[model samples]
Target: MAYLRWVLGRLTAAALTMTGVSVLIFAAVRAMPGRYSDLVLGPLATTADKAEAARRFGLGGSLPEQYGHWLLNAVQGDFGISMASRTPVSAEFAARLPVTLTLTGLALALTVLVGIPLGVYTGTRGKGGGRTGRLLGSLGLSVPEFVLGSLVVFLFTRYSLGLTVGEYVPWSQDPVRSALSLLLPACVLAVFCVAAVARTTRDAVLGVLVEPHIAAAVARGASVAFIVRHHVLRNASIPVLTLTATLSAYLLGGAVIVERLFNAPGLGSFLVDGLDRRDYAVVQTGVLLAAAVFITTNLLIDLVCGLVDPRISALAGKARS
Candidate 1:
């Protein structure tokens, strides 16, 4: 019953947040200096053509009515037609979503696998390990994704490594080749994720070490491994969970530049192409889908945190009450 209540509360909150985001996006996009027609028709288009294009895109109606129509169409999974490509926004997303998902998934997996263990080691070992951690973290955080991606491409694709450059094989067609193609880009994307997560985890673990219970365990001659494995890690994990969730949300939209650099068929590339052409339907749908991914990721993270530490769910329940 508690779990069910928690789920319901989260769902309600997520719905409200998503609605607010949609409204803000709608208003912001509409408030941009030019009309949707201006983007689609270009500067040389006559006034009459601009008017006709606006009407076709439903920009002819009052803002509220236009928003309502668009929202209704969206609810029915019709993202309307892209003014630039004349393709359905839903179809565009459908085609590119898998690529983004695959890349992000690989990057995230690498981040967790590499970051957490290294953080734990640094926190537990303190002196030498901590110094090493700081150096690596600084290097990772200082490098931008674009620079990192370029370097990787140069080294792996153009240099002696002789890896194929910017060629993606669909996983369903050839999973090995697809994964191989993704390795450089995924590593570039994962660098920042790993750095941020490692720093957060290290701080959280260090904080946990000073707790009374942890001191008691130390005084009682508990093994370092035992204390770290059982008490310290458990308590420290809460913040790490939140950080991971936030990073995942960031990765969904933040991959645009990286995707473009790699020429990967991801949602970020789709969004960029749409923006370049002033494809209203594509832009709206892609942004909304990214927002949805962020919201969903956050909710799932909250649920996982609640499972890990019942105090989180208790706090949430109290807030609702």
Candidate 2:
């Protein structure tokens, strides 16, 4: 019952967060300098033409009214038509979202797999792996995603390791090629996240290590592995989980940058295209979906952290009481 209550509270918070995000995105979209009307009708279009275009595109009402209308339709799965492509935004995103998700998922998996172990090693007083992890983490943190991407492009182009140029194969038809294609871009996307995750994990572990319980475990002759598995990980999880949530948000932006750099057919490039064209439907849908995704990911991570330590659920129960 406590677990149920905890989940319900998280769900409620997520819903409110999504509502606030929708409002911000709506206002920002409307505030951008130009509109679908300006793009579709051209400069020669008169004020009447522009107003009619706005009306046709469902941009006709006051800010609150427009938001209400958009939200209503969006809830029903009617995510407006694209000003640039003249297609339903949902349909367009449906095809591209998986690509971005897959790429980002790969990047995140690599990050966690590499980061946590390195952090554990360092925090546990391992000398060699810890030194290498710290040095690489520092360099990774210092480099920008675009710069890493450009470096990959230059190196690959100059070296020509037999891979096709400008090829982006989808995983549906050919998983191997798709994985190969996504590898470099995924590395670029993961670079900063890996460093950040490693640093955060190391700090969390180190913080837990100084606690009295950790000392008790050590004094009790617990193996390093046993102590880490039983004490350090569980105690350090909240911070690591929080960092993962933040990293997911960072990954969304990095995905967009790397997709453009690699010319990958993902929502990042799709969203960028919409921005370049000033396509209200496309950009709004993209931002709102990304926000929804980020919120949902955080909720799941919170659930995991809560599960790892039921005291967290107890805290939620206390709040309700």
Candidate 3:
């Protein structure tokens, strides 16, 4: 019942958060200078044409009215029509979202698979290993996504690497070609997560290693691998999960740059194109969908944490109190 209540509370908070984010996204897009019709029709378009465009897009009303209209329609799963594509915003996103999802999912999976084991190894190896891991983490942290992406592109180009560059293949058309196309971008996106997760896991494991129980287990002739597997990793999982959850946000940000760099047909490029064309519906829908992704991901993280460590709820309750 406590867990149920906690989950319910979290759901409520997430709903409120998303509502606020939607409003802010609406306002931010509107806050930009120039009208959608102006961008669509250009200077050559007459005033009457501009007015007609504005009216069609529901932009004839006051800001509040326009927002209210959009909000109401959005609640009904009608994201309006994209001024650029002249198609339903939802339809446009439906086409592009899967590419973004595939990139993000693959990147995250790679990060977890590589990061945890590396962190565990370094954490168990003492001071020298810790230094090496920290240095690697610092390098990863310091390098911005664009720079990292540029470096990858340069190396791949200069070395004539067989990896696909700036070409995207849909998985439905050819799974093997699609996998090859996405692999480099996913690997590039995984860099930051690798550094962050590795460092976090190492620190968490080290902290757990110093616990009295760990010393006792060691003294009891428990094998190194046995103690680490049973004692260190288990206790350190909470922090590892926390770091991964936090890094997920960074992964999304990286995806935006990586998608553009790789010419991947994902939401990042779609949103950028929409913004460039002043396609309000597309931009608004993109931002809302991104917010949904962030909210949904965090909510799942919260639930998983609750399952892994029920004490999390008690801590949250105390914090709230």
Best by lDDT: 3
lDDT of 1: 0.84
- When sorted by lDDT, best at the front, the candidate numbers are 3, 2, 1
| Residue 1 in model 3: lDDT | 70
TM-scores of the candidates are: 0.92, 0.92, 0.93
lDDT values of the candidates? 0.84, 0.85, 0.86
TM-score of 3: 0.93
Candidate 2 wrongly placed segments (more than 4 Å): 1-3, 46-52, 126-133, 162-165, 319-321
Error of 3 at 104 (Å): 1.1
Give the clash count for each candidate: 0, 0, 0
lDDT digits (tens) for residues 229-288 of candidate 2 = 989998887888888888887788778888887888898889888987888888888998
Residues 118-161 of candidate 3 have per-residue lDDT tens digits of 89988999898998899988997788888888888889878877
Using lDDT as the yardstick, the better of models 2 and 3 is 3
